[model samples]
Target: MESKSKNAPAKLHLRSGDTVKVISGNAKGETGVVKKILVDKLRATVEGVNMITKHVKPNAQNPQGSIEKLEGSIHISNLQVVDPKTGEPTRTGRKLNDKGKLQRFAKKSGNFI
Candidate 1:
């Protein structure tokens, strides 16, 4: 299914461990920290988001392999940054401060994401 979002989230600005919300897909409203970024696909896998289970065969580590829960990719467009201060979804932007250091800030709370 295709996501219906007002704006596509910028991919380069996001990183692992960043908190995000699923804004316009089947998983809308679900929030989680980014676990990995699939830049080639313009998608990301967020912890606890778009989870899927896969059955596995026996292995040396697990003798009897079992089903494992794993995260699936979600299009970057469906994700929105979660404000660290307000704990609400927000947009991210970069700005140069007086110190000449470029930093990312949350548009909604005006705080660092």
Candidate 2:
């Protein structure tokens, strides 16, 4: 039997700086920019969504230990990229442009994303 861990990383359609909406969980319906992608884990961190608090240890950057609030990662499946033209969440697809270069486009708006 094949182990799940041996499976290849998930391919995500979303990219950094792309605006997205949370499709599920506590932050559902919230929109934010895709901050980072963890391909191996199939997760992405969205700004201002999934806020988490962490205890911090002081270092050169700060003399006092403090609590830090930061964005937490959400599964890639839970995010839907927002269509720039329509201002709505939409599916993404890749296709060749007139120059034959591959480009990502919004399936809903039928426009380049």
Cα lDDT for residue 91, candidate 2: 96
Q: Candidate 1, residues 27-80: lDDT per residue as tens digits?
A: 999999999997767799999989899999998999978999989999988998
RMSD of each: 5.8, 2.2
Off by over 4 Å in 2: 1-9, 58-63
TM-score for all models, in order of appearance: 0.80, 0.87
| Clashing residue pairs, backbone N/CA/C < 3 A, model 2 | none
lDDT of each: 0.86, 0.91
Candidate 1, residue 21: CA error in Å?
Answer: 0.7
lDDT of 2 by residue, 1-113 (tens): 87454677555798899999999999999999999998777799999999999999998888798999999999989999999998999999999999999999999988988
- Pairs with steric clashes in candidate 1: none
Highest lDDT against the true fold, candidate: 2
